[model samples]
Target: MVALDGPSGTGKTTVARKLADRLSAGYLDTGAMYRMVTLAVLRAGIDPADAAAVAGLADGVDLEIGTSPQRPGFRLGGEDVSAEIRGPEVTKAVSPVSAVPHVRELLVARQRRIIAEVLGEVGGIVVEGRDIGTVVVPDSPLKVFLTASADVRAARRSSQDTAAGRQSTVADARESVERRDRLDSSRTASPLRAAEDAVPVDTSELSIDQVIVALCELASHRGLLAGCSAEAAR
Candidate 1:
């Protein structure tokens, strides 16, 4: 298994998907799972800061996540919410909702189950999130903690938002990213941090393709790319 953990705007989503594709493995975006719960909290009109209320809502929410690297899906109560979870409303509220301890407990259990299932079926899986290496899959064969400069991450986030039809400025994106970093790193439950054994890759000056190549090399070095061809693994 491969655990890709990092803060927002570091290209975790894109790199995880592409790396999974290259390795012919399943992919799980654990962040999207949290976003699904955050959306449910918003839809119920519950305050995200109200930990008890949000945890109660999360306990009963039916979340279904797809593991396909090519087309992973997020469903909330049988409705496809893949795109909706990426909106600004969810983005703004997700940090608080995800910080709740019970919510993390619930999702971490589900994530472990999904990871086991995918590993059994596909022989490998790439899981990405804020705490995957440190909390979700501590024994993963390969763990990567991706990082980038705040300015570069903010610019990437702005471009991503604009491309997705969301209006955002670099300044706004920087504030949002930094806010999330503070909240995620300071959260009491399974905080955002790199595991001691995780490989750190600074992506401030590297392209997405370069990051993927570096991870692929790491996986290969760890003997995790058993079936992949030499060219694809590198």
Candidate 2:
């Protein structure tokens, strides 16, 4: 198993998906699970700050998460909400909603179950989120913490938002990223942090392919690329 942990705007989701595809492994965007709950909370008109209420709501939410890197899907109560969970509304509320102790406990259990199932079925899986390495899968064979400069991360976020049809500015993106960083890093339950054994990768000057190649090399060295093709392991 591989654990990719990083804050928003660090390209964790894209990198994790691509890496899983290259390695022929399953992928899990644990953040999307939290976002799904956040969307559910918002749709119910519940305050995100109300941890008790959010936990109660999350308890009964029927969330189905797909592990396919090529076609990940998130369904809430039989409603496909993959795109809705990425919108600004859920992005803004997800941190607080996920911060709830019960919510984290619930989702972490589900995440572990999914990981175990995927590992049994596929023999490998790449899981990405704010706390994957530190909380979700600390014993993963490989753990990577991706990082980039603030300005670069903000620009990347702005470009992504614009590409997704959301009106965004660099300034606004920077503020949102910074705010999320603060909230995630300061959360008492399973805070955003790198595991002690995690490898740190600074992506400020590396393209996506370069980052993937670097991770592939790390995996190869760690014996995690046993069945991967030579081209992919290169």
Candidates' TM-scores?
A: 0.97, 0.97
**Residue 217 in candidate 1 has what lDDT?**
77
Candidate 1: stretches off by over 4 Å:
227-229
lDDT per residue for candidate 1 within 1-234, as digits (tens), equals 899999999999999999899888999999999999999999999999999999998989999999999999899999999999999999999999999999999999999999999999998899999999888889887889999999999999999999999999999999999999999999999989999999999999988777777887788788878644465535
Clashes of 2: 0
The C-alpha stretches of model 2 lying farther than 4 A from their native spots are 227-229
The residue pairs found clashing in candidate 2 are: none
Per-residue CA lDDT of candidate 2, range 73-150, in tens? 999999999889999999899889989999999999999999999999998999999888888888888999999999
Model 1, poorest ten-residue lDDT window? 225-234
Shift of residue 147 alpha carbon in model 2, Å? 0.5
Question: Ten residues in a row with the worst lDDT in model 2?
Answer: 225-234
lDDT of candidate model 2 versus the reference: 0.92
